[model samples]
Target: MKRGFLEACVLAAISGEESYGYQIVKDVPASMGLTESTLYPLLKRLEKAGCITARSAEHNGRLRRYYRITDDGRARIEEFLAEWPSVREIYTYVEGAHHDAR
Candidate 1:
């Protein structure tokens, strides 16, 4: 459940344009707790899923991998946006109930 949301965030970050791994992690919210260890695996998973494409280019005489959003990735973003309202409502309800409990 939460993994889908994480995937959506990664997709959105790369959606702007192809970006390197480090830069992609930077674009994500700090609250996500995304670190290189976490983000690298997630990027590999996304690439394996065909949601995005990774290509290597030489910059400063070193190979750098850049991620680009695919058509499927864009569609995924749309799906996430559509479900966001319901997710928001759930969060609101849970927070209210939890606060009352506290």
Candidate 2:
């Protein structure tokens, strides 16, 4: 199943020890299999909602803005986790029985 739209940012923040846009673009596919365009706007919204923050850093001699999840972002992840069981069950059942040609 495709990860939820915002899931990339949350996981990316956690994985990067805090990360910037390029890092997220690189890591998200490994974590969530999402593309840069899909993840960037969600990060922007998370920032706007105070669910994350960013600061500039030097990496490979280029400046980049790194992101960290806020307390609220953590809370949101918890909420998503709480809801995951039902979502997972539904998808699992659907996929298992779906298009079976036996």
Candidate number of the best lDDT:
1
Per-residue lDDT tens digits for candidate 2, residues 1-102, read 354645634554554388767667776546465567867777788889877887888879988788888888777777777888898899888888885744
TM-score, every prediction: 0.90, 0.72
Clashes, model 1: 0
Q: With candidate 1 superimposed using the best TM-score fit, by how many Å does residue 13's alpha carbon deviate from the native?
A: 1.1
Report, for every candidate in turn, its global Cα lDDT versus the true structure: 0.88, 0.71
Clash-forming residue pairs, model 2: none
* Span of ten consecutive residues with least summed lDDT in model 1: 1-10
Which one is best on TM-score?
Answer: 1
lDDT of 1 by residue, 1-102 (tens): 767877888899988889988897798887787788888898899888888999999999999999999998899899999999999999999999999999
Query: Which segments of candidate 2 are over 4 A away from where they belong?
Result: 1-9, 58-61, 99-102
- How badly does each model clash, as a count of residue pairs? 0, 0
